[model samples]
Target: MTIKNIIISGASRGIGFELAKQLCAENHQVIALSRNITPLQALALPNLHPICFDLQDQDAYKGLVAYLTEKQLSVDVLINNAGKIINKPFEDLGLQDWQEVYATNVFGVAELTKSVLPFMNKEGHVVTVSSMGGVQGSMKFPGLAAYSSSKGAVITLTELLAEEYKETGPAFNVLALGAVQTEMLNEAFPGYKAPVSAAEMASYIKHFAMTGQQFYNGKLLQVANTTP
Candidate 1:
């Protein structure tokens, strides 16, 4: 198999961490980005490169581009898996709360994708991770007004990007995930048991991120067995 240079965000734990570990085990060069990369560094895998990255930081994007340029790495897959959520009732949600969520979920995804496009291989894939709550008429909860709406925005963004870049080469797709037993899930829904584990979901995402572009572009696949 041809080794691919893959970039994944939110790699400190959960699905992102599993993706980094699994991809490196397969001999792929993995660039794992997260605010706290200590967990990733502990793995000490030669093929795994952990970088301290904050999705909300503008300076971090520049640093990432510089690092990629310095390493002369051409990205084959870019996974926008980093997300932020504030679980507050709509009436209690302040402007800052909404901004914080969108900064990471929507704006960060857009900025990071744009920053990495020049380094992407013509046949590369960009996968943005969304939530089932974002899909219109799926299932609405009380405390996800900001989080869910931001996710919906990215779905449209991905479609627009795929259309614009269709003639260029690289492809864009978004995945609306179902409930997974992740730290984020535990935080959002305390004491709730999810049918899927983080590693299990990560495995599916790993396979999809590497090969899904061959058959899908500008498509939103709802990877959920249960609703939130």
Candidate 2:
């Protein structure tokens, strides 16, 4: 059967917005979420539904499960595409720094997955967007300590779900991608060097989200052009 309903986080802009736009173009119902009270005008597609809510809000997801439950929203796919990276030295990373990253990157994804699990079909797919730093530890970068660690946590979480969901596991995978041209990078670093178009990454991610691998859960697939 053709999967129809897809729920994506971080759909305000960047890869998330692009993916939502493309998927909706293909006629899939997309429930887009982000940490903003303001609606995302970027997703003007016919099948896109935007929810303006911040991940840091304590009661943001309180009634989410119940709402999905009441609506019987059968999610064919869940894309955990939300995250942030703070560039700074390890010592410079403070408590608020860690909280900020985890709140959006780790905690939000984990909570949203939990909220949507009951509504997700057994054969559905769960795709999390991780970074190349998650795979290699990114020791070369000065400001990626917290960012890299958060991604590592995401990877670890994906592995656990892969093992636990063996029988009825949602087909899962982590896209360890390279640079993508988006507001995320520019916002994090006003003068960063790594450059890649977000549109390309969105195209790749949208394709994979539709094609679920039966045995590739917890595996990290790198997508950097620098590699020959």
Candidate 3:
């Protein structure tokens, strides 16, 4: 059997859900998390272990750790895919909006990661799903201040963690995902188009992850609108 244990957050739908479903199909045991506790009937993968909790909830981590420890789960991969974006003009973006965005996308992720790291075995991989907007100048649409900034912070956090963990830290990368068909985008840009489908992106991410290329560490895997 393969080293199948992985934890995927933000997995109720979109790229997170697709990645979890596809990984399970490839015989990986996926521990999926989202605000909603139930698994989507459409993603009928037997290897999926579902957990429902709002990442912002401090109480959730203890229960999660207790459950995993009871099961004697040692993780091979830690996927920080859970995040929220509020695409609004900086001026128009209220403090509450930014707080909400950071609470889920940044602070919560860091908390979960910190809580889970001890359970990750050596050589385990950590993948953080980020955004191209976090990269260099992009003349993209408006109302992206909160989302883009938070993603940039996530990338920085990934790099810092990579350095801190050194050999013990799993090879980590912040994948800067291009436009993908997701509910988040649909809500923000109603008539907007995406460069790829979530399933396709998931496939590419899984493949990129398996390569285990050292050069990719502490760098951005720029998966464009193309094959990625």
TM-scores, in order shown?
Answer: 0.98, 0.91, 0.92
Weakest lDDT window of 10 consecutive positions for candidate 3: 207-216
Q: Write the per-residue lDDT of candidate 3 for residues 1-228, one digit (tens) a residue.
A: 465688888988888888887888789888898887465445666788888768888888887898889998888788888878776777898889989999987897788888788888666778888888887665455788888888889989988988888777677788988888998889988988897988998888876665654456777777785532
Which of candidates 1 and 2 is the stronger one according to TM-score?
Answer: 1
The order of the candidates by lDDT, greatest first, is 1, 3, 2
lDDT of 2 by residue, 80-166 (tens): 998988988899889999999988889987888877777766678899998877776443456888888888888888888877886
Q: Judged by TM-score relative to the true structure, which candidate is superior, 2 or 3? A: 3
Q: Candidate 1 — worst ten consecutive residues by lDDT sum?
A: 219-228
lDDT: which is higher, 1 or 2? 1
Residue runs of model 1 more than 4 Å from their true location after superposition = none
What's the lDDT for candidate 3? 0.81
Superposed Cα deviation of residue 109, candidate 3 (Å) = 1.9
Model 1, C-alpha of 42: deviation from truth (Å):
0.3
lDDT of 2: 0.79
